[model samples]
Target: MDVELFKDGKRLDGRDVEDLRKPLKLEVGVLQKANGSAYMEWGKNKILAGVFGPKEAIPKHLANPERGVIRCIYTMSTFAGLEDHGRMGPNRRSIEISKVMREALENVVMLEKFPSTIIEVYVIVLQSEGGTRVSSLTAAAAALMDAGIPMKEPIAAVAAGKAGGKVILDLNKDEDNYGEADVPMAFTKSGDIVLFQMDGKLSKEELETAIDYGWKGTEKLFELQRKAFEEEYSEPLDKKLRMVE
Candidate 1:
């Protein structure tokens, strides 16, 4: 039997099969024309998100009389990758992602503040090496803050992978694809998880371990998000908004 060990009996690029790489970067207020926007890069995964309104609702039926409504659109950019499909358009995958994202966000935002208004969130996946959903969630939260939308709390999301029988935090592309399990979690800065998803099979113990990794990773991400949020408020953002990311 030819057994290719990931890294000395661990998964490839090992750090206990679940240990993730460092160097996560987030940029807030990237789109000058949008009411609020942000970009996030986690390893090779990249996502750009924009938040618009509390604007007057469009299509009379879509309007709500008691609370503001949220509409989320998620799409993949053409240049995100050329390895497989080259075309870009609304597909089943994008539709499902958009719906889930909207549900996740609507849970925390204060919609009652803007009744009869619409809050639009657009997430464009620039790269989808791994954990794109988590990245989108994190980016959306940042964009919402930039737009000055009041939320119950800031949400931070991260993915955990189990490789070589070990749980790792924040899986990159290869780890996510080849790993035994993938678990993504979204949480508030206060340590409350609001959204969770899992792929592949896992024992109860394994699931707990994955959740632990996700929580730790989310905490790490929260600090970066906070810093980004503060920088936007410190001064007027230039075109590049290249001040202290």
Candidate 2:
């Protein structure tokens, strides 16, 4: 809303407008009953993802004996934000996002190993600060791992935005609202892009720069995911050793 007022290219959180909010907390196996579950928060954006199966397919029409099907359901909670109208049932946006997410994840998961089973990924947005899709993707990967699904590798996502003619790493709500362009991508640890999408317009040079920025951001984000998983499993063992001592 106030694009002209963002002087010195500074954001509300003191980030250089090109800086991304490092993921705050990432947890896996958060939902005890689910086959796999994860919750992650990036700045004010919060997301939760759960995975069920590699089990029998629910809708037989979508099933195939040669590969496992990826079923994704994307929904934002009623309290996701004040601006998001509370409406039940799947919307066009959710359906589109679900399709994108499914494609992104299918590339890495060893779906053929399951054969005819279904892997259902459900993403729930608890808060929407911006970059919700990227946040959801990160959570989905973590949840899939927690469920012990066979995956070629874990994946992470990052958003690159253009502000003041400079490509930035991540744009929060305010910057995104008025920024010139936004690009979000999901990548594997091996530096492969599994999903890519963008909005707004940009020059070829700027687009290349944004893509570079997004890749760099993803590297750092992957480390955060790994650390979180380590910490979750490490803490209990450390406490048990301390008790024995």
Candidate 1's C-alpha runs over 4 A off are 1-5, 9-11, 14-18, 239-245
Q: List the residue pairs that clash in candidate 1.
A: 6-12, 18-167, 18-168, 18-169, 19-168
Give one digit per residue, the lDDT tens place, for model 1 in 177-218: 677778888888788888888888889988888888788888
Clash number for candidate 2: 0
Per-structure clash totals for the candidates: 5, 0
Question: By TM-score, who's the top model here?
Answer: 2
* Predicted structure 1: lDDT: 0.82
Model 1 CA RMSD to the hidden true structure, in angstroms:
4.1
lDDT by residue (tens digit), candidate 2, 146-181? 888999998999888786667787888766778888
Runs in model 2 lying further than 4 Å from the true structure: 237-245
